[model samples]
Target: MRIPGPEPRADGGVGAVAAAGGLHRYQLWLHAEYGPVVRFQLPGAETAVSVADPVLLEATAHIDKRPERLFEFLAPLCEAGNLQVLPTAEHTPWRRLLLSVLAGRPSHERHFGQFAALATDLADRWAGQGDREPVALQKDLTTLSLRMIGAYALGGDAADPDKVVTAFEEVLTEHLGRLYQVPVPGTEEERARRAAQALAHLRATVDRVIAAHRSGGRTDRSDLIGALVEAGERPARIRDTVMITMLAAHHTTGVAVSWTLHLLGRHPEVAERVAGELDRVLGERPVPDYADLRRLPYLDMVVKEAMRLYPPGPYGARETTEALVLGDYEVPAGTVIFYPFWAVHMNPDHWPDPEKFVPERFLPEEVAKRPRLAYIPFGIGPRSCEGAGLAMVEAELVLAVLLKRFRFRPAPGHEVTPIERFVLWAADDIHMLVSPRVA
Candidate 1:
């Protein structure tokens, strides 16, 4: 695949690597050479294949070991698998039918207290800071999402929320960075040893919650823990599933929110428009909740544009169940077929002025013109994100709260470089100065 400029090509053979960039730049390549199927082999491990071929992607995502291999790129913190990283067969069924935190009692809809508390806390703190100092809006927002997700997963007073996030990021960053380099045997051993220690701690943490809930511990509550505690007699799977769910929902949401903030900061006009809409939808001292998100049409558009520009996950892959042929590319079982999110998000045919930051184009009339699968921020088909509903609410709500309160801009020289993998992130930092929107 050919992307005009100096970006790396798909090594065609093996050991070819590409630099981290927005998916739009990579879309040209995916459609050109690979059309739908592509190959990539990181610095270490086995040779792998990648594909944006939607049909083939479905089968790959369904592979039992697919999630596990993907997780290896993640810190072992998620090795246990979050909803996103779990093997397709195991995760899909439970996520689709069995588990119902999103579609069940105390659904995200019923969780206003948690989301509001987070937004309020952020406003109160930032409001009092006095000076218009540049804040890493992304960093602050990520912290908020992590804590809120913890509250949802465990109880309101989930154990050491900061510690949980710190450990998770350490493992995630460490593992992702290691991908660009060779894995030393000694380093692998060290990571496993650390992972074992973390696993022991995590198991202990899960055990305590299980023990408490099983032993008639009741807070007159029916939060995430309570639902899982009574997950239909299969206590172990339920508990494991809860732990994994938090892992999936927490960090992914945080990174996505961070990117949104960066996009709004960079595009001041869009930021102003979103703020104006927030005012219309929610008047003085407005707080975000499930109900308010629907009224946030501008905020929703902004989010879609951000996801289009800087997708949290630019690529997703799966393994073949049997021999498959697509666009003249053939692959057998055990081949890692990849579908780069970065590739699909930026096809010129699909996106006009693809490099520019424009949100209104996502309006219903315009969106209806795009082909199916052309815009897949949350992905498509069976393997699409189960938490998309929750994510949409979370994003719109956070954007509403933030845009209403501050006028943010990129720091003097901060560049929002992104890392391409399971999620996209600012490679350096998203530093922004937040001035009161005194308009």
Candidate 2:
């Protein structure tokens, strides 16, 4: 069966769809108009098949090679190799090492204090602002997430956290903004130069952290940098690994929290429930800690539902390694299989009233009724994000802290728009007026 798609444009095929900054919407339209299996083009690949049906996705779940050309923009950030495209043999061990650290509950507990303190700092700042000021949700949360990741993963202060995050933001802004642009904008030349500078600064900072780890004989050898050093990894590998982890780690968690807050702000009743949960769980504490995670089921559901609507990394791609049959269609090896989480989350067949913000949909009882793949804010199968646990813990903790301390309401006249920039992000940023919580 021939997969359907929009008419291919002469200048760039379907590249304009992505470049237009509505790839998610376009994909949804494609599915709605053409059915679950739709074909489209990305800059280098002309025949990418986007599979939205959960049952169909299971057929391609084992295909784990990320589409190389599509991920090339991130190539510059790594040195050991394009971490995203490492072969299964090499990728397996690397992923295992990451899982040992990033997915460990012990590591999260060790770093929980640092994460809570950083979140509380932001809450304190907002509380001090007297409740009426507009808070730039993405900007502040991204910074907070970076700080927490830096402290736990790279040893933030020892790594010059401020400079590292600034350089990273510059690098990402420069590269991600140019992701779909063709014929390269004239102004990108200068931006490219700045991106290079930012990259240099980042490498220098990572090198310094590695050096400190080596020379200090530090007692706190539990951080990611220390674990890497103890494992005898190469300096360049360590640098790239740190950058890659930072690249994946920071934005998703931060963006998740921002979107959750944005959704909660628009849905005051849900916000009230979240706040009530926070209050009941920790009567006087300003933030949720490691142990408090299990006690806040409502907060967990709220975060899960928010992610369903605005997944931080909205889509994932896999290049088929072998021919596979998917829902009556035989897809050949080398086909790019696009798994759009946003589309799956909104599939009317799986989710009733998919666009509505209903945290109850994620309650344990409700969740058990759906297909496992039906709610993968984190991608499914082996290639799913290793830091999923950490991101959730961080997001929930931050949400509890902020909501307990403040009530967020949408600032008048400001619109929040989601765009794909590596991660799904608000184009103008989620702006909200903060006020001290009454209860």
TM-scores for the candidates: 0.81, 0.94
The candidate 2 region of ten consecutive residues with least summed lDDT is 179-188
Q: What are the per-residue Cα lDDT tens digits for candidate 2 across 313-415? A: 9898889989988786888999999888999999999899999999999877888898778888889877899889989989988988888888899999999
lDDT of 1 by residue, 310-342 (tens): 776666555555766554555676665556666
Candidate 2 accuracy as TM-score: 0.94
Where does the lowest 10-residue lDDT sum fall in candidate 1?
1-10
The per-model lDDT (C-alpha) reads 0.63, 0.84
Q: Which stretches in model 1 have alpha-carbon errors above 4 Å?
A: 1-15, 18-36, 40-49, 53-68, 73-89, 97-99, 103-106, 157-160, 166-199, 217-223, 232-239, 327-334
Please report the candidate that would top TM-score against the real structure. 2
Looking at model 2, the pairs that clash are: 131-434
